[model samples]
Target: MANALRTFDADVGSAPMDMLSALFEARGWQCDVHSTEEISGKVKGSWATYQLRCIWRREDNVLQLLCLPDIRVSPEKRAPATDLLALVNEQMWLGHFELWSDGGMLLFRHAAMLGDEGLLSLTQAQALVETAIEECDRFYPAFQFVLWSDKSPKDALTSAMVDAAGEA
Candidate 1:
């Protein structure tokens, strides 16, 4: 069978970011991936806008994805953001959202191990992007509530779960 004899020439290829860049661009995201170390782009979701970044870690042969929301958790909101993020993180499968300490930037972070596991396929790469963006989009309103309102973390999370029984 043709499949049985096919060989993967891992040596001839570049880093995983190359394929990821192409994939991101093809999906209508204007991606900047010319640098050997990292790629950055923007993605617009129905619920929120996110800044996207993919970085190559040479030491670990891993590609990491970061999706950062434009909102910052104010010092006053940090407590609620922490509680909300913890609940949301428990619900995530791939990456978890984090609130950075210094600037309180809320970010979605996920990583893929490359070399030892073989190259990251385009499908796999896109899946990572989908997971990150979906989580960001899914939980965006929770953060917004925590940042701008007087809602508790649990209440904020509950508010984002809009009910749509028959609609898709």
Candidate 2:
């Protein structure tokens, strides 16, 4: 087996970070570009405030997103929370939520392998964030139901996904 060749341009070292910064800025997000390796911002959705963090691995051309939902899962609820996250993870397309048991914290995480290439595209950066927001927004209510309402994982997912309103 051989290692895959990275396609990133040597001169375009900042492409990924720059693209992320610009994309978040365009959305009026105040992001902290404290380092080339990471950029973070907070997006307030209708349901909860989400903290979005993007980390770039220059050596591998991999950009990963760590989105923390505002809710905190407690130790007592860890068992059911695991069930809830598992169900939601099965339904997700972009990322999955992980339980950091040490703190009973849950976070939605995803990564994009850009591979060795030229400068990252603005569209690519935007797509990553947009997908994250969409997935987080869609599933947040389910997490609430599990953590707060004592709802079963199956029912939580159903409540989160059900569209009761027919064509108006």
Candidate 3:
């Protein structure tokens, strides 16, 4: 990997979002949290959504992370960001997963899949999230977790692959 894709030893913390945001900002990167509702018009339907987005410029290319709460995947009518909190309900089955680009970045998403009654234990839910994060780090040295949103930039993967291949 090129120096441009250098890895940072992220400090483990209770607040994942705050920790991530601070880590990136310390490196001169910018992070933003955008709601699906805010960018809904840009997509198609008026679905309510929320996301945490991070952006950084690597020379001419831009890197980004758009983190979305789990409810964004539900087939419910449009609701506010608060509705996403229900995704954390005790009866849900939680799991975490990460999707990484060949270049060297990752998109991490965790969900507490709702069931008929209660939520999964915190330990169980967290285990899934931990697994996903670990997998992403193992696969991509410069991974950035993001939400699935229309406003999220799309070129990071392609650019990273090109850069990686060029180094070879």
The candidate scoring highest on lDDT is 2
Better of 2 and 3 by TM-score: 2
Number of backbone collisions per candidate: 0, 5, 9
Model 2 residue 64 distance off true place after TM-score fit, in angstroms: 0.5
Q: What tens digits encode model 2's per-residue C-alpha lDDT throughout 1-168?
A: 111112333334447787777666667777899798889999986578899998988788789998888778888888988998889888877778898867887888998888667356655766778888878888888888888899998898888888322213
- Per-residue alpha-carbon lDDT of model 3 for 53-116, expressed as tens digits? 4332333222233343222222222221113223222212433323232322223444333233
- The 10-residue segment of model 2 with minimum total lDDT is 1-10
Model 3, 36: alpha-carbon shift in Å?
16
Per-residue lDDT tens digits for candidate 1, residues 139-167, read 88878777888789898887876621222
**1 or 2, which is superior by lDDT?**
2
What would the TM-scores of all predictions be?
Answer: 0.85, 0.86, 0.24
Which whole-number lDDT from 0 to 100 does residue 33 have in model 3?
A: 35
Select the stronger candidate by lDDT from 2 and 3.
2
Clashing pairs in 2: 6-116, 7-116, 7-117, 8-116, 8-117
